[model samples]
Target: MQIDLLRRKIGLNFNDGFAEVWLWAPNANKVNICIQKTEHRLDMLAKEYGYWYLKTEQIRPFDAYSFELESNTDADNAKLKRADPASIYQHDGIFGDSTAFDLGRFEWTDQNWKPIAVKDYIIYEIHTGTFTPEGDFESVINKLDYLLELGITAIEIMPVSQFSGNRNWGYDGVFPFAVQNTYGGPQQLQKLVNACHNKGLAVILDVVYNHVGPEGNYFNDFGAYFTEKYNTPWGNAINFDDAYCDGVRTFFIENALMWFRDFHIDALRLDAVHAIKDFSPKHILAELKQHVDKLATENNRPYHLMVELDLNDNRYINSQQQGGYGMDAQWIDEFHHTLRVAAGQEKTGYYADFNGIEDLAKAYNDAYVYNGQYSEHRKKKFGVETENPGEQFIVFSQNHDHVGNRMLGERTSTLVSFEMLKVMAGAVLCAPYLPLIFMGEEWAETNPFQFFISHSDEELVEAVRKGRKAEFSAFHIEGEAPDPQDEATFNRSKLDWNKAATGMHKTMLAYYKTLIRLRKENAAFNDLNRKNTQARAITDKNTLFLTRSSEEQIIICLLNFSKNQQNLQLNLPGNMSILLNSATTEFGGPQPTANAIQHNGEISIAPESILIFSN
Candidate 1:
């Protein structure tokens, strides 16, 4: 029997007095829609493909409802009241009644909005809860100009989907369609997207489609949403290839489309694609791309799907014609890891696999440093070698995982010197890939982004605590990991916006602004073609010389990783003039060299600094 996954719209679609509800439950003998406000129950007609649907003029928009599913095997024929798995709004909680929302009612002012190109994107990744003190969508709206002033092209928000509790890293999100009620619900999110589009800032939403979170997870009671055939770090993997898996795939695929079609989201950053286990002839990601491409063609605007994948396999970003997943771009963890190692991160755990300077150089040349190489961390040969375009990779110095996963959750600012911080920023911005900055990274905010969650289950809380500690046991960090359930942990993670305007923080902010400006305005730096880039690591002096060139202009970037000043010479054709120097007095660094053209292609670089010379 063939199941048409997109045959009918799931969830409650409500008008003024008309509503159509659809639920997927193959195991249910009967299903009923129970309206919470009027206490009215209506029996749904069981249609083909295991779907129960009801079309009535009784329910209106904003009405809260729950599904009643009666199993045939139950001797009592008891019907269980469960929140709609396809809920758009869950006002009360994740386990409470689902609210029917009129998504078309929002007045959008971004009809003429144009999306930023993927190659030129300078992304500012933000955690909604901690990005502002108010911890909501409206509060973020207040800081739009601030972000624009910082020169980021796009704002990549961390997951805003409804999670177990008010506070989470958002990986624990269960309801894929429901916007977090604590974060002002679905309408607020619509407003945020609309505002971003109007401001010429593309919004990239991070979505988790791996294993669903444990708390409030009622998928088992409804249908076959998970399978024992595969397991993720979270638990049993989402059913993507098992029997009745088409419905599960369709549910998530529709969720992705809803973000773009309804909310006007510019792009979606698919979280951790490596964990998504699917062995179907046409993989789930490929199927999603096929659908997204179809919508993009109709909308007449480019929509993108960037993925967070640790797997160095380029198949995810390769085009569908080449038998690949067809993702627009992917987060390159190798770039982050190798750069961190070169910047003096402790060579332990995953870092043990990277050998600093050489590896960083390799990452700059090839997208993956460990391509087809034996990895000490994994104890196996990892990552196939492939030629992927530079624009297809998203590079960053320090993101949430880098800082938050640590025992104390220390930012790069807390871990490295101020001069080295400049070097780190230059390394990422100067690369031929798109750059992403974590929230508060520009001004070097010192707040620890420690892991925090508010799961209502005490046993689950304890398990998380124990699991966190066990995960860090190999790192050899002393003291217990911070209590993830504690409110203090979440509070401690909030950004201090005031720091961006004061003292060294202000200077760092200026430095970041300059770097971003150069990245956007400079001809050579703006070109993302890997064929026009060259990176060579000087091991003895601990320096890297990177050359980027456009058809008309060329620039040579010198980065010194050592703490000592080093004199170096690049044997290039023409005389080079200093474009930007991180060690200049204007950027809060000691002026170690007079600004002049290197006629002989020789110059002295300051300790832990970056210098750009253009011909």
Candidate 2:
């Protein structure tokens, strides 16, 4: 029950006619719940282990309030007002007052929904701020049908946690529990997730635990929420192993479980976990996994935790009983890096280390390309050898990091030719890994996913621009870096929905739909058992032919990344038939006279083309 209280309790809990507020403020001598409009103050009772509680009928749903704190850290030990760190909903925005909300008030019809396994996840990642013109949760609900038509089984939303101002990448969130008020707050988010569940589309929320935004962070005033012992790219690290770390740990762990318990989210994507510094025996990641799995069992639904780490550690993907963090999967950058460099991407920064075809083959056959190998980029040996299949890795040719982090914010559509795009698409989907397609990637939306955040603080804004400019010196990027603070930069990043169904965009969208269908309809595409899958790259021909079988039928994908046409011979046991042909006129091909798939012997592959054959 102590653990359940740690997970299920906290924040404002409403029952019958009254609201009960729970808070963790170890450093505060006294705390008062203040009503925003009337200034009604209610003293909270302090309990054992630094917990405080107050039950009052005066507090009800949608009541805007803030905490009045009397702390020893103050200049005269004077009282100050601050928004709840565990606020469920904010009134105006993160800069405004936190509000009380009742989850029971909302209606939901997805009680009988059953989500698919992690291996079957075809994730379509969306940045809620730039996904639509309105850029709110209610507006995103209007487009869920369009996503389903694209053949995506899961929708991974970029973090919606409350950050400063109206717009942000959401990595700068300070209020971990509060939904962004600019995105229609918590109620609208609930509607969006529930609607997605009803449409048989699982929802994955991107969350950042590594660091918090500079503005609107009141954790320092309340307790020991940060540690100066270690330094990250974001300056001070979170207090995970320092004094009063228990409350800090529980606070984050509870925030994770609250999403699954209250909002009904299927999975969470932990962002940039490589920056997370923890030395405790029971890591914060393991604690989160343990709590999530417990909640999953109680709710009787599938729960997944996917980390964005460059460490290439299988412990994240391994089962808990095996002494791992028990994460269902992780986003591996090697597959995308290898495929891009092989497809003629400029070798800059870490891209310098990847050996085009060799790395591609290694990523396809094994989960990592640098397992126990020397990394010229980092000037050291990186990663441990893992026998785990592609199921443990989330591979993609294009993602937010690869595109948004670029100096010019150019996607695969802008970087590569039309023909090579199809080849890369086939490689991503055909590989034995969980495939994730970024928003507007299906129809090849031309908008650049630039780094933008609307912070009201001018000093912080200047710091961000200077940091970005300093960071750009390392990359081979052309043109002036877009000012992340400018409204034009944020507006320009928004997807052009109308263009998604016109000319080549329509054709590309159709081609992507077909690829997704093949992956979903065929069992061989997702059968991630490495023992049954074979990946061979014909280095001489600059071609890759990956084959997967289920003892019944074999799925073969022949990809030609070369600029010139190549001829390859197949030594197969069964009669091969074409499952999908990228050289067909339907996908804007040259209308080749010869068939794409040959049963046996020799086959001609068009330049920068792909062909999927099943036997």
Candidate 1 local lDDT, 1-615, one digit each (tens): 222233227777764467877788988988989999899999999888788888898788888889889998778888899998889899988988999888778999999897788887899999999999999999999999999999988999999889988999888888888999999999999999888888889999999999788899999888899999998999899999999998888888888888888888989999999999999999999999988888888789889999999898989999999889999999998888888989999988888898888988888888788789898899899997767788899999999998999988999999999999999999999999999999999999999999999999999999999999998978898899999999999999999989999999999999999999988888898888888888999999999989999998898888999999888876666566777899888888998453733546667788999988788
User: Candidate 2, which ten residues in sequence have the lowest lDDT sum?
Assistant: 1-10
CA RMSD (A), model 1? 1.8
TM-score against truth, every candidate? 0.97, 0.97
Off by over 4 Å in 2: 5-7, 592-594, 597-600
Scored by lDDT, the top model is 1
- CA RMSD per model (angstroms): 1.8, 1.7
lDDT of 2 by residue, 566-611 (tens): 8788865557777777977889888554266444577888999998
- Candidate 2 has an lDDT of 0.86
Which TM-score value belongs to model 2?
Answer: 0.97
| lDDT of candidates 1 onward, in order | 0.89, 0.86
